[model samples]
Target: MSDEGHWFYCLKHMRVEYGPGCPNKDRMGPYDTEDRAKHALEHARERNEAWDAEDADQGS
Candidate 1:
């Protein structure tokens, strides 16, 4: 698959960027779509919540 012109959500800058503007460690991903990249933070929050709930359930 061609990786040219990928989209990423920069955690450090809190913005969407095309191609490699920031380091991978500080970015969300080379998302398939720009819209998906834009929702990176929301997805992260959902995953975090799910993980937290799982942890609580395991603890109990």
Candidate 2:
């Protein structure tokens, strides 16, 4: 994707970055907006929890 107006959560620096700052490996994603990038960790955690719940349901 074009790195024009995307946002990323830098895992190495633990901060939100606009456009391109760090390498792709150290970043969370190309979030659509700055606010979403800022909440990357929270969103990841929530997604993980949901996936875990789905797994549990399947196992039962």
Candidate 3:
């Protein structure tokens, strides 16, 4: 996606940034909205939990 209107969660600054704030390695995403970018850590945790559950289910 284009980086013009996207938002990102800046890991280094711990804040929501609008359009190309920090380097990609120190940020969460090009989320469509600022609110989504703000919740990046929560989203990541939820996804990780879901993936872990899926892995466990597959193993079982």
* Clash list (residue pairs), candidate 1: none
Model 2 quality (TM-score): 0.93
Can you rank all candidates by lDDT, best first? 2, 3, 1
Tens digit of lDDT per residue, candidate 3, span 1-60? 666899999999999999866788999898989899999999999999999999999999
How many clashing residue pairs, candidate 2? 0
Number of colliding residue pairs in model 1:
0
How do the residues 1-60 of candidate 1 rate in per-residue lDDT, one tens digit apiece?
334678899999999888868778898888978999999999999999999999999999
lDDT of each: 0.88, 0.93, 0.91
Q: Model 3 — TM-score against the truth?
A: 0.89
Q: Pick the candidate with the highest TM-score.
A: 2
Clashes of 3: 0
TM-score of each: 0.84, 0.93, 0.89
Query: Could you say which candidate leads in lDDT?
Result: 2
When summed lDDT is taken over every stretch of 10 residues in candidate 2, the lowest stretch is 1-10
Model 3's alpha-carbon lDDT is: 0.91
Clashing pairs in 2: none
Instruction: Please list the Cα RMSD from the true structure of every candidate, rounded to 1 decimal place.
Output: 1.9, 0.8, 1.1
Error of 1 at 12 (Å): 1.8
